[model samples]
Target chain A: MSSTLLRTVPALRGALRASGAPKAAGAMASTSFVRGKATLPDLPYDYGALEPHISGKIMELHHAKHHQTYVNGLNSALQTIGEAESKGDFTKAATVAPLLNFHGGGHINHSLFWENLAPASGEGGGEPDGALKKAIDSDFGSFDTFRAQMNTALAGIQGSGWAWLVKDKAAGTLGLVTRANQDPVSGPYVPLLGIDAWEHAYYLQYENRKAEYFDAIWNVVNWKTVAGRFEKT
Target chain B: MVNIGSLWQYLALHSTLSGDSTNTNNTANNLAKMGLAAYTLPALPYAYDALEPHISAQIMELHHARHHQAYVTNLNKALESHVAAVAAGDVAAQIALQQVVKFNGGGHINHSLFWKNLAPAGSEDASVAQAKGLVAEIEKTWGSFDGFKTAFSAALMGIQGSGWGWLVKEAGNGAGLRIVTTKDQDPVVGGDVPVFGVDMWEHAYYLQYLNGKAAYVENIWNVINWRTAEERFAGRSEEKTEL
Candidate 1:
């Protein structure tokens, strides 16, 4: 039975490859060269840097344990796919697509999340000044309004998920969207700013008071990084 | 008007005096009072810790009380509002409620099925003998019972994020049995009848198993109520034959 199942996988993958179906946005970009491994990225600042807003203990676990787990899972999934591809067993690749999406999304989202924060000093929080600022004001009326809207939306997430400030490339508009679980905001929209609403992200700091956590997160928002993303978009 | 009022009073008195054992009168009254039937969370067929060792008591308690109850509550709210929308002929409002309906409805359906599909390990009856027909069908489809289990576990392990793995009986097309997976509380659709389902959501196993999903999947088999699967399979197959 195993052999019979394996036999058809390669043919299926070959057909998919031949059709050249457009991959979803933010798929494993370096699948060809990187093969199966994903390494966890370093944080831009110390774990305690966010202080008051986000604690060092939370940061340490969120990054070292939670983020590392995703990195490991993604790598394992990629390895399985690579082996199947090598053996012309594309069926295995097809089966592991969810792992790629889940862990891959986890890895991708966490990577962006780390860069999305900064220490209270220097570049963290305050306000956006340039094009990003104009976009926020133009799209959402004002910075305060945008903050209020994002906070409300983040607070309303029903489960482990994220709330994003995404720029629609085509429309050149900023929109607020919340995703359930580790699902990434799909491509064609550039993520300018995102708040991880997963319990692990804020539970340690704010407990059940999600609103308080949402309020605190803005203090550590890396406006500089967000503006850079906005410029590129 | 005098005659009609007298007749109505007499019928009401008779109904009250009879104490209608069928409760039809009460049902009619309630139906008239409430426009739609409200869905409620079903009580677990077994004790919270009945399937112990295999599934922790704490997991079952939270899963049933917290998770399942939330789904039932949200589903009722969604359906209640949807009733108003449907009555108003509000197409946009009805369309907007589709996700809420599917998510909550599916959660209700799937969890209800999940609870029934498990039993205390070793406590299952020798009724596998009575379910010979379904057993034969399973053997025919997967070469043997073990083969079917292997395929089912493989499918279960492959669920990317939160989802369920099902052993479904597909009617017609040879009355085949298929192993299928649905993402994020999606109930089995099409003409397939799910004989058994195992939730692969992290919340389902994270507390007990932590990240060891493989162990959870393996241990779950020990407590699966095969009798329930057999009954479901038998009923579905009979339906197909009749069709």
Candidate 2:
């Protein structure tokens, strides 16, 4: 989700070179000023779909309020950066970088997270099979071992963060990685499945026993999405 | 390990003496106003195990030694960086460092107050009678002490993320008491007096209470240092010796 703007930058420059001077100037406007606002994506299931594992109230607040704040932050940060840069106030533009990173990463992470979840009554919990399962087994010895390792990583986070099942794009090997705060998985890693370890993720339902929330989330894991991302990577 | 002098100095210099909390964005301004002195972890008022049974020694040790220390350490680092940024005329760097400053700064401030806000369960300060003025104000504001407890507990539970619930004295002429929650590491800045604060972050209770946070909240009253709340409420804490 965050890569959209990044991917457009080079493409916009390419258009500028390919067009005539008048069209090139027009392309410059789009490239320099136009920004697509990040929007909160709709959840694939009802707020209560993952109930008993994650409560409806948690889901509602997480999606509607928390996620919405990130979206607004990202848009506001981008607007500030754009306006600052246009005015030649690089300091102002640079000052907004942290907000851009936090909110942008937050927007992207939550967007992916909502999709990676489904109702436990449907395609939620259970282990992945086929190629994804084969890769997990090869990389981590077995599926159970992989799940346990992920849970360990989740538990080990000292503060707000996430544990992810990621595919190393270069090696095509599966591994576990954790990020502090809203940092999104980037570089060569493709996040297959992410488990949010932030207190808000489970403090309401699981309270301080976050391990229960960690263990229970697998009941609605949505391995189908995990498999799709795994194969595509 | 409880250094009474530094705690007194901290409370005197920062929360009360500063007397400039009205602007919500005044954290950086306050840091500059104070000449950007480094912050150190204030010693707890009691031994780690003093609040045991209600709050375990393990929780207090980790909460104070680990969590609060990190905030103090990080806040000083952010301040140092901000100093260098200001010297070099690096506006972006200075601005970029504000969030960390606010977070770690608030963390330091809140934890400092939180430590002094608690006492050993059976200690004299733990009794409501020690907080005579605050109790009268609480009864006036909420109609009854039980009512205030119920409302405060609800506020604590209602926090969606890591934060603190504070019983504060409104800054204006009325000086009314109110329950408020600040998200993440944000302190009850502005002119309001945070008579007492409850750390709602999972680290404060997760070790002993597990998913039973309600039990922790209920048990907390047994350890609350109402004497400190009374001083803060009566506005006598500014005198420094009242505590």
Candidate 1 per-residue lDDT over residues B1-243, each given as its tens digit: 124534554444434433432343443333333455656678888899998898989779878987787777677666655654554555688788888888888898899888877888877532345457777988998999889888889999876556899988897767688889998778897778888899987667766765567899999988887777888887742422321
**Candidate 2: docking tier:** incorrect
RMSD per model, one decimal: 13.3, 17.9
TM-score of each: 0.69, 0.53
Off by over 4 Å in 2: A1-191, A199-227, A230-233, B1-36, B238-243
lDDT tens per residue, model 1, A154-175: 9666556889999999999998
lDDT string for model 2 (B27-130, tens) is 44556655764566788889999998999898888778877877877786677567655545567888988988888888888898888889998889898999
**Candidate 1 deviant stretches above 4 angstroms:** A1-37, A44-66, A69-103, A118-134, A142-161, A178-187, A197-224, A231-233, B1-34, B125-134, B236-243
Q: What proportion of the real contacts between chains A and B does each prediction keep?
A: 0.03, 0.05
Docking class of 1: incorrect
